[model samples]
Target: MKKILAALVVLVTIGTGSYSYAASAEKAFARVEKSGTIRCGYFTWQPAFMKDPNTGTLSGINYDFMDKVGHFLGLKIEWAEEVGIGSVTEALGAGRIDVMCASMWPDPAKMFHTEYTLPTYFSAVYAIVRGSDKRFDGNLNSINKPEVKVCGIEGDITANASRAAFPQANFVGLPPTADGSQLILSVVSNKCDVMLGDAPLLIDYSKTAPGKIRKVAGVDPVHVFGEHLLVNKGEHHLKMMLDTAITTLVNSGEMDKVLDGYEGVYGAPEKAFKPLR
Candidate 1:
């Protein structure tokens, strides 16, 4: 009888927890719909997404895509100023933003802190080096040697991934915000030997400068992952809405227009973000 009672208690406890989560999710769902504005936190990254530093402009596939989501939801996308990737979890928890539209990768460490929508995109990490510095080219083993000075921005996901993957090499960390400008500058100016970052951004950077920085060709990504929009934890309804909106865009072919130059992974479109036809 005691064992049966204990089992009943366990079931009841689990039921209560689930109910609490559902309640919180409903609050979040109603909150966004009531406010009529989804405040999206974002940072200025590169290639696929960024807030232009010079003009303070938010222009990228992320912005363009999320704008459509807001429209469909009968809400306006209120752009919230977010400076660094490291502080995104804090921003969402502190109620600074309703969602994170920055090209944020759902790192394992952060998974417990926030809810993530299905990935809107996928990108590969590459080694950024000077065009003339062909030392590591086609040689995966070369970058792991101690002589190679690989750098990543402090608190950035790449920092942890690169450090873990290349323990043999000297991995350095620049201050926050270096992921955009300073990381590349360090590689180009010889302040660092190499940078492990997104391949598309590095390729575009190399093109702009012609030879200042180039991707180490033929090196498969040390890390490849999907990017997702994030919201506060327990906001299950909010996440579902976001997931549906993303799939809707993909199914209707409007996502192709926004993701024109970016790479991503899309699931089968089930629910439409709007009318399919």
Candidate 2:
């Protein structure tokens, strides 16, 4: 009995040490501390994120927020435009980027790969139709018919929502290569009849192609979508750090300042961003 107790105690000690090491290894914030930088990922979207047309400097609300986050964390920000909406989830799951502050919603489908921060903004699907295309109005019932070709990026909630909204409508899903801007351009160029996307993205579109295309109706009442930051799921420390950073920004008014700058530059009002409560 004494020998058996000794063996059990030895086993417990070994298990405890192994668990501690594994826990330390899985923590991404600790890894960041070791490396001394936060690897951030952004995407190609105006106002939220954009490569400045003249200076080539990256600018936007997301950029500003991330910069502030880096300062708060006492780490250097090494940012990159990593992937589009379609590929971002995969990039997070695979750990290609430590943090993605881009077009991500609190999509339950992505729960396995990432821990989403509190929402920073709200977006709704809007229908973009040519001013001259009178076939379909903005009404959901009218656009849900079989004849409408609703163009959207593949593998997005927008595409899913389009299908759900208009089961009879011929929903055309483009490859991930086609982003929000491309979807809008498709409609403007007559390649596609209608473009469906988040309101913010569509708002950006209306400005560029003024009077050519209009929001067919109004914002969809479907479950509103939003943008949230994502970190790998197992990285509890990283998640906590990011969450703290996000909360800090949202609280400090520094986030508001950055957002105001972007809003002014992009001609969007401060009300455009939906605070994550």
Q: lDDT: which candidate is best?
A: 1
Per-residue alpha-carbon lDDT of model 2 for 163-257, expressed as tens digits? 77678888888786456677777787777787665545656766766677766654454445666788877665566566667777777777667
| Candidate 2 lDDT score at position 109 | 60
lDDT of each: 0.70, 0.66
- Estimate, for each residue in 109-149, the C-alpha lDDT of model 1 and write its tens digit: 67778888986766666777888898888976788888888
* Residue-level error in angstroms, candidate 2, position 13: 19
Clashing pairs in 1: 248-273
Candidate 2 local accuracy as lDDT? Answer: 0.66
Q: Name the runs in model 2 displaced over 4 angstroms.
A: 1-21, 24-27, 53-55, 134-138, 218-223, 264-277
**Weakest lDDT window of 10 consecutive positions for candidate 1:** 265-274
Model 1 RMSD to the real structure?
A: 8.7
